[model samples]
Target: MVSGSGVFVFDSSGKDYIDAVSALFCATLGFHNERLIEAATRQMRELPVYPTALNRTVPVVHALADALSAAAPIPDAHVLFATTGSEAIETLIKTTWYINKQRNPKRHKIITRRGSYHGSTIFATRLGGIESIINSFDLTGDDILYAAQPRWPRDALAGETEEDYAHRLALELAELIDHTGAENIAAFLCEPVSIAGGMYPAPKGYFEAIRNVLSMRDIPLYFDEIVTGFGRTGKMWGSQTVNQT
Candidate 1:
């Protein structure tokens, strides 16, 4: 049993330990933050909850959306809030399907990397590449594809430089796309830094190479920055940290 306060949590025996993982990487401001509490209280006192669907929304939701859109790297980017990261991943997956179904009906598959962990929902779990998580479910289908992870320190060839490794991985991704048929793929989803799979940051130029390939094919790239967003990777977003532009 444990109780939390600030950045520390006390165990059953009263031995306090610093929460190094930020409560599974969500509590960036730590526990018992008075400002956050005050904000929540203020919102509750005003309009605590509201639906955002069917053209219904509250001031706070619009404010959040405006802030997020302003901060996004992409011009004209919009925002959608989900209750959890899993739901967000689900939304991404569904959005990809929806867009492709309308624009390119055959482009319904998503390409992710080996060892990536997207979420726990059916489609999200299938999008993930961890065998343990994937095998637990009956999702032996082709809607999701897996490519090699760009972990240089571990996957690099003995004589390969980081640039060479990145190039090789990009080639591998291109090969996968070719084999799968670009018309059958919707997008390539990835984490700028593979934290949950392992702390495997992309090698220099890795993202650029992959982005080039995807761009030539006109396939969209989705960045799952749930863990690495909001300055977790020493930048506003891991995409920026990894030089993805």
Candidate 2:
């Protein structure tokens, strides 16, 4: 597409199509938004560029961080900003890696659901659950594990209730953990609603069951809220929608 307006983008041939993907799901706000344009103009006129380095940050950075932390569901929340979703996810992965290194070096593996996506950065790409992307790019990693996605009807049993299916998945996860040795696992990462592979919301009690399994082994759970943050799911965070902690 050459350009976009509202939810539609125009091609070179003058044909307009609805931008259903939202530019890799990053630009939540539609194009040609006057408020966003004005905000960008105002910020640029004052301070064109600034980087948040060691003990140094611009006023806008602090203000935006404060606003994000204030709205976050995490208690005593702090904000970490990145230029792209990929960078943010990469940051999170590194943080977990660092934590595991300090706590237990053996616990370095991260388990993610099949078809789920964290980002496209080196480690983030390895964390993704899309098989095609992984195989095509040769992005396989020994420390990353893939589990089945909670795709509802497609994977559900003939008469399995949503809760039952979720429990079954949890059991499967527990088995995987046991086989791999829970002591060697670092974290469990996933998107609350799968986006990269396809949009699919987990069945109710999904996180609850997953938590039950993870808690028994004291595994940390993390979610990639790239597309579901800032009121995207009618809430400030997708964790709220999924009742995940």
- On TM-score, the leading prediction is 1
User: Tens-digit lDDT track for model 1 on 1-245?
Assistant: 37788989888999989998888888877887889999999999998888999988998899999999988988998899999888999898888778777888999888999889888877778888988888877778878899997787788889999999999999999999998899899989999888777887788889999999999988999899899898788889888888875
Q: What TM-score does each of the candidates earn?
A: 0.94, 0.91
Instruction: Point out the worst 10-residue segment of candidate 1 by lDDT.
Output: 1-10
**Number of the top lDDT candidate:** 1
Error of 2 at 33 (Å): 1.8
Evaluate residue 134 in candidate 2 and report its C-alpha lDDT on the 0 to 100 scale.
Answer: 81
Count of clashing pairs, candidate 1: 0
lDDT of each: 0.87, 0.86
The per-prediction tally of clashing pairs is: 0, 1
| Segments of candidate 1 deviating more than 4 angstroms | none
Instruction: Estimate the TM-score for candidate 1.
Output: 0.94
Per-residue lDDT over 137-230 for candidate 2, one digit per residue giving the tens place of the 0 to 100 score: 8886689988889988678999999999999999999999999999999889888888875677888888999989999999988888998886
Off by over 4 Å in 2: 8-18
RMSD score of candidate 1 (Å): 1.5
